[model samples]
Target: MRQLAQSGKFRRDSTLLEAAIEETNTEIQERLKKDRIDFDFDPYFAIVRRTLKALAKEMIELGVELGKSRKSNRIGERQKFVSEAQTPFEVIELGLRNAIEGLVALPLAKECVLDLERIKQDYSVEGEWCPFRVSTGNLKFIVDDDGTISISLRNPSETVVKEAKEVLIALASQVYVGN
Candidate 1:
């Protein structure tokens, strides 16, 4: 019902936690004010609050001197160390996702989640580029020129192969339109 300012600098004494909530709610209300939507807002706020609180915890632990002068605490070296601490798996995953994001129409994680099992099925070049494949699961999919998508049923026995086929068809359609 009210507007929350997202201006100025972050403050230590301000109720940032509450301010974030009010700010998010105000934005959501403004965006949806024209729509005829009947839904609960508490669940959304709960998730936002949880995430904001977690970030607040990280900020506190990182200390008030997070971005202080490099001369005082060697800020550049501290950042280098933090960046270097990431595990190989984390780096690889980041790279893989970045590659997919750059090469494909979909977000990396969404693309991976959608095509992982299907990609594992093995590919034979279809054309200069073919927009679709039929997996062992009989999934109909678009094979990204830049990716090897694997497709398999997480619980093969629980779901029909037709589901994968449907996804593949949808993916192919998107590729056709996007390209």
Candidate 2:
């Protein structure tokens, strides 16, 4: 009985040690990924694209609701005037611009700089004015007036890229529900 108890204790200790080693290895890998300065923008761009799509959907829904309300005779004339003053496309564009600006203002994106004029002048391949551009080191995120987003990443860190995605998503959620 004594020998069995001792062997059981040894096995438990070995298992614990293995688990600790595995945890440490995982931590190291995470640190390495975070520390990596060179990032490909494809993954990050996908994230942003998805976020923008969701935001656009929300904006459309809001616009439709506003339109429906305006069509009702219950709304006062002044309220109807206010609602009709801005078209749905205009509202969505303004909301998108504000959301992008808000994303840059987040703590994670403070290190990133947005240059609207530069993006318009340099990166607008469609011959249309680009509304915003965010730069982190050599990475650039350009958004055109028509809700198209493109990314240029140079020595971009995984941490910053992930944070950028998070910031955009958070802003989208906040702006979508008027919170």
Candidate 3:
């Protein structure tokens, strides 16, 4: 039922850790004020509290610092590390039913948690592009002398979302970022 303060200047990764703690604590407080949780969700609430409180501890220990001289501490590597730290919070933030299901599957060792968490971010709900990947699906394209362009995605399922088709129609007008 209350709001947390805006984040201050981020001098280090600790800033994010502090913000995560504040966010989870605030969410718990609001739930207590506004919801009927005591009847059934007290244990789950404890898990939520404990997990989100340490959202950054293992990650900070794993070398997600901005200027770390470690070889694997590059920006790309940091992106993966940050995603690992954010998985538990995402179960709350994104309302992902599948993720919650995965978390409930128990008997997993804590050591395996890192790679398992990485799986959570390995994809979008839809899909992604990779230039190196040889797209085996039937893809057709054309570029006319007048520079008109068109593309066709031939999916094996033969079902592409209407939104994706709409996007393809408008794609030519969308300026390429690098260009």
Which one wins on TM-score? Answer: 1
For model 1, give the 10-residue run with minimal summed lDDT. 86-95
Q: After superposition, how far is residue 41 of candidate 1 from its true place, in Å?
A: 1.4
Candidate 1 structure quality by residue, lDDT tens digits, 1-179: 01121222344423556676776676677678769555568887777677677565445434444434323544211111111222111001111211211111222221222333333445332434434444433433345544333243333432343354345334332222211
Cα error of candidate 3 at position 60, Å:
9.0
Regions of model 1 farther than 4 Å from truth: 1-14, 36-40, 60-63, 70-179
Regions more than 4 Å wrong, model 3: 1-9, 36-179
Task: List the candidate 2 regions with Cα displacement exceeding 4 Å.
Answer: 1-131, 134-140, 170-179
Task: lDDT for model 3, please.
Answer: 0.30
Top lDDT: which candidate number? 1
TM-scores, one per candidate = 0.29, 0.21, 0.23
Per-candidate count of clashing residue pairs (backbone under 3 Å)? 12, 0, 0
lDDT of 3 by residue, 1-105 (tens): 011111222334455556655566666676787875544455665665566545444444344332343333322111111122222210111112212111101
Q: Order of candidates by TM-score, top first? A: 1, 3, 2
Per-residue CA lDDT of model 2 for 1-179, tens digit only, reads 12222222223333433343445456556667898844444565456445555444444455455555546633222211112222111111111211222122111121222334443343322333444554444445555443334443234355644565543333322222110
User: Would you list the C-alpha lDDT of every candidate in the order shown?
Assistant: 0.37, 0.36, 0.30
Residue pairs with clashing backbones, model 3: none
